[model samples]
Target: MVQSGLSQPEKVIGSSYNHAKFKLLTPSENSTKTPEICHAETIIVGGGVIGCAIAFELASRGQEVLLVEQSEIASGASCAAAGMLAAESEDFAHPFMAKAAHESRELLHKHKEQISAITGMDIGLRRSGFITPFRSYSDLSKYKDRRNTTSGVQQLWWDRSTVQREALWLNRDTYGAYYRSLESEVLPVSLTRAYARSAEMMGARILEGVQNVRLVVDNHGVRGIKTAKGEVCCKHIIIAAGLQGEQLMHQVGVALPSSPVKGEIMAVRFPIDQAGGRPDRTVYAEDVYIVPKANGEVWIGATSLPGRKDHSVSANSVQRLLGAASYWIPGIKEADFVRAWAGIRPSTPDGLPYIGKYEQIPGLYTAYGHFRNGILLSAITGRWIADLLEGKRAEEIGIEALSPERLNRKGVML
Candidate 1:
């Protein structure tokens, strides 16, 4: 048998490259000899929120984990997401997503202090609540009855007077509005980076620029990954590669039913008091959201453009979001736009994430298909994947709703 794993010498020879756009720290020059084989308890492909979260959980539980990313952490949809944690704002018709979304929020709230302590960064976790204003009385009346999941959940109904009192910058000509206290917001990139930092501190190896080409499954199960460089043998493999899940699945003869749904967003800097109010909450209005961050920057976005795979920001998308946002805020038309970016969300046909193992592949599991909820759901995704890796039942969330087996029944082409 060939001796595998990084030799002692190779560890010393890698060099670090630092540039504004990107950075790479190569294996040391005295890097240990590249072993003919590599081994770990788990190998996570992708460095986005899903993979990083799984890596963090596995490493925390004393499992040797390897997280390979084709690009920098938070470079995928995780980076482009607006970080809204409102299961209510999303389609409530899907009970499974609703439950998972709520549970994920609970998990994020529970782990806030620990995450801050470990990452030395505030996750920009704001429980400031969310307000959805309406210019149409018909729309206002639709939600005026105040319907939600639980009786304990409070939905604040705001008439014109209340909106004015709260400094909700609606033109006096506006109608009424509603506020959901359960909804909150965070800076997605910041939160994701914190997870990556914590995972690295816990002894997880995060290798950027390392693309996983395929999984190497032996007679028993997944042995490791076949990367551009070489094979990495691992006992368990997690496919958290976002929209790339189907391609990876093809390599192993399993059909992962997934597709890419693209969206674009723009970032802007604005003074806190520009809205003529003391800000304490996020504003979700007119199919757009205005999230105030602690750092004096606000993220307003996210126009859903279905079927666009390229990550280029289009003029129409920028104009449309800006127009819609300005219609809600009125003042945003005067604000200076800072930056714009796009990402392709991994979407399932039914809009729910796939978060369990393929029944055919013993050691292979999946945690992708998050779509727009990827950022908000990352915290719990790690724990859920960890449960599967440990052969324990998922407590906070039910996996049967999102089981890989369920997607197979949909008859999607491989």
Candidate 2:
């Protein structure tokens, strides 16, 4: 289901290489001899944050889970994400989304300590908060209701003077800033690897570099999946393959209307003692965001170009992002340029993720179209999907609004 225009696979050397460091499967590896057919309770397609998290949850709950990935884990959007857990900052047009995001953020915070302790990986989970600067009061008025409805979130409206005092590098035109103290950030690649490692430790079979994957369906329901390596016969199949999920579902006569939204981001480094030393929190202004890592590297992103599939970093996007960054933090102009990269994020018409069982096919489930929130919602999506498969009610888990049926009922063409 992981489709790419690049035909050849990248070469990977080691067996236990981290997803962030590993390359794709080589040509010879893709033609390896098929092994014997395997069986599992559930087969999850895709190895991004969502899939890895789901695998971790299901395996931890004692379910026999097999995760198949066409490429290395977290090699997609998960690795490119800025890792902002912005439940409060996100648009909550649908009340249920707000609830789900809130719950997901809580779960992320709750498990941050435990996961880091177990894996000994610094996930860089920080509750350093997020700030959205406003150029005018009219701009602030537009999101007043949304900001107020962020219940249980610590919200503060800082005056221009306070903003200048806290973030001295901001532009003079900045009027004020709305701060959400509970919003957090994490190292997405580290988190995904941690989840995958933890799931494997708990008996989940994760197969990477698997090519030519196809779903095995029967008159009753989805039987399992077949890959270049071998076949996996399972009771259930989950499609969390991000942008490629639509194509996979279409193979089974289901129309999943989703598109790839391309985003470009850049990382800039600064000396520890420099005036541009990493900011204390994530800052958003004029559709650009600056996320600081503990290592004095600031991630300034991102340009969201909808309906774009190419992951090529454009000069225009990079110039625009850097200009915005310089406008927000004057010192950013002097920071050392690190690298710029791009990713294609999956999105739906309504900007809501599809996270439930498909009615047309039994034992077939989906957890894709998360758009920009995949990393933020990964923990709760996994937990809820595992819960649903384990016989928990949708209403009980409060994810009824995220059902796939909503898209079908709307009659949106795939």
Candidate 3:
């Protein structure tokens, strides 16, 4: 439910503090009389997968959680994701990041059924293997010898004949592929909705369609937040607002370097009944990835353009994506074009999401800059947030590595 925004500026009752002023547009009657002063143990901003998952995790731990969003949940990068729960395919700068992804995917495996049961929404979580076709033999030759010793991700070598038997449609010039059983697929929107709905079932409150969001800070730390939908008083605040979340963090002077990366993806109608059938599993080629959806449309994507904020899909980008996919799976040339869209992913300079507390500001934390792994990491990110808030930490997840202050030492903080 969306709360009404304020019509004018309202003063917050607190001592001298640093707060940004964004005009609220709520019912003036309510503001002139008494602003809606609700209370919660924690107030989470941004209703994407990360925000919703954090709400669910906190509620599951018996914490009163309130989430506020400027738009509908999952309308950002969360919904735009291709929904590949990938760990091995991603070339991580840190081994712990990969390990964290593996653990997060496991969390999804453990909680998907329970969330679906509570929300009555099929989250579409499946154990679909992922294949990364290698263009040259030297690349396949290396992975053939050993697995990822650091992250413990299993690997296998699939010869060209094996590829044909498994995915007959992929009649390409590629020599072989590196296969990993850990990568899975899910419906991004469905998974995000399931998390949000389950959180509501557990008594968590969600406010959508809010605007002009700004935090109320004091000497102690975050006091509460003012929005177009009145005000909320809380002890803790976690910003998971995706791309737009950077603005809030910047205003707070937390100095976490965050940027945007745009990814354009499309779906095409595949004729499954044709002579050469489609692959049962997802395929990641050199230039593109093909994901089979429940609606018989093979979702092929995407073109990653960093330092971009807009979601406009360029005709040249579409042509490049389609051409690359067709080179691998010739059926794509004949497949009917469906639709295409774009999403701006939140990214950081070092490529690691900021997950821990900012010691400079107590009761302030962040789960932003997750980039493309937001969907895959949402579950574990929530668990980590809960752990951090309760004066706890998970060593295996590398809490310090994801700290918001890690990059500040390099003097990159804004």
Candidate 4:
């Protein structure tokens, strides 16, 4: 519950009249003839969490929705995430983002049961909470001040002795830890697939393995989308394309400032009977996080390389992550190394995600650049997009701060 600050001034550049003057065709548009036209009320791009969530919400509201994906749903960053729903643990620069994250985390609680019931898939939703270990008194004091300023978050400070008693595998050098009881974790891939399955059940068409996808726009607004197979005639299109969003938006004459931030993570298996048993909750130490799954497997991650895009795991990153994990939980060093992988997350200059209709391009909306919090923010972003398309007032959803126009004013290049 961080205190609110003055709302940033809206930086919309020009009126709708100025935007209507430019009519640009996408690269695919020039070569394609009038492709077979399929129709839907709304077409959503990128079948990841955000897109699938929005499709599910829209379909639940009885909107005919079409979701197009270049690859399988959740095959990108959505599946590679550690799935920590740490709203309270995340550092928010704005009060609005904090509130939105809290609300989204709460939404997960409400939807978890429903999603499992509908999809018949256990999403591995766990309320294991999160603990942040500190190395020294000065480090603890610095975080204490930050946490103290946050109004309604429930946090508990643990002494070194208490921390040792609670998590026996922790290093003796650990000074203390802060525990946030409301934090939770989930299996990101399962949760994302659940959303896609539920959306399909609710009558949303999800087209995976699509190729040569591009937007078709006119003076009025978005007319449809062109794909390798055909064209989808739709009035509204939402882009939640993750790392590929920048290129997609650029094709339609929109400048989205986003880049691929690569993260490498590993999975390790531990025996249940091992000495200093596996941690029952998520543990955070500096840049390292260890998430324990119910299946005797633990996830150790991650190294954020901002400009890197290759999914190949480097030995150096793996060594660093594993070394840090072992320092936090001594028993982790003994665990069987399962696998290592990487994903490219979409990152923005400012940390906040872009979530709103483009003022310059009517009927074109975006929900991308969520970075690490994509899984945590999926539910709320879906609801927000649904609300906007349904003509809900901007103030009702408090989405003004996340408007795409902010990037426009910042002179973000394609």
Each candidate: RMSD to true structure?
Answer: 8.1, 5.2, 8.1, 10.1
| Candidate 3 global Cα RMSD | 8.1
Tens-place lDDT per residue, model 1, 1-414, is 111111110111112212132222223333444333266778888888788878877877888887778777767778777788876665553666677777778788765677666656677777878888888788766654544444334577888898877745545555777778788777776676667667777877777777646788866878777776556678888889898877888887767667777877776655555645324567777577777665556667787767878777777877888787777666776666767777778888777787887767788888888988887788788888888877765434467777776756766535
Give residue 248's lDDT in candidate 3 (0 to 100).
90
Q: In candidate 2, which residue pairs get closer than 3 Å at backbone N, Cα or C atoms, i.e. clash?
A: none
Could you give candidate 4's per-residue lDDT for residues 105-182 as a string of tens digits? 989887788776666667677888899999899987877776524766778988999898887877877899988988
Per-residue CA lDDT of candidate 3, range 1-414, in tens? 111111101111112111122222344544443324367789899988899999989988888888887877777788678888877787665788888888889899877877866766676778888888876788666655544453476878788888766667776666887788878878777777778778877877776777777888888998888887777778999999877767898888766767888888887776656625566678876578988765466777888888987767778888899888888787788887877778778888888898888777888888999998888999999999999888885354467888877888777666
Error of 1 at 358 (Å): 1.4
Q: Worst ten-residue run, lDDT, model 4?
A: 1-10
List runs of model 2 lying over 4 Å from the truth. Answer: 1-37, 142-153, 273-277, 410-414
Of candidate 3, the 10-residue stretch with the lowest lDDT total is: 1-10
Deviation in angstroms for 352 in model 3? Answer: 0.6
Q: Per TM-score, what order, best first?
A: 2, 4, 3, 1
Which parts of model 1 are misplaced by more than 4 Å? 1-37, 141-153, 271-280, 393-397, 410-414
Q: Return the TM-score for candidate 3, rounded to 2 decimals.
A: 0.87
| Model 4: pairs clashing at backbone N, Cα or C within 3 Å | none
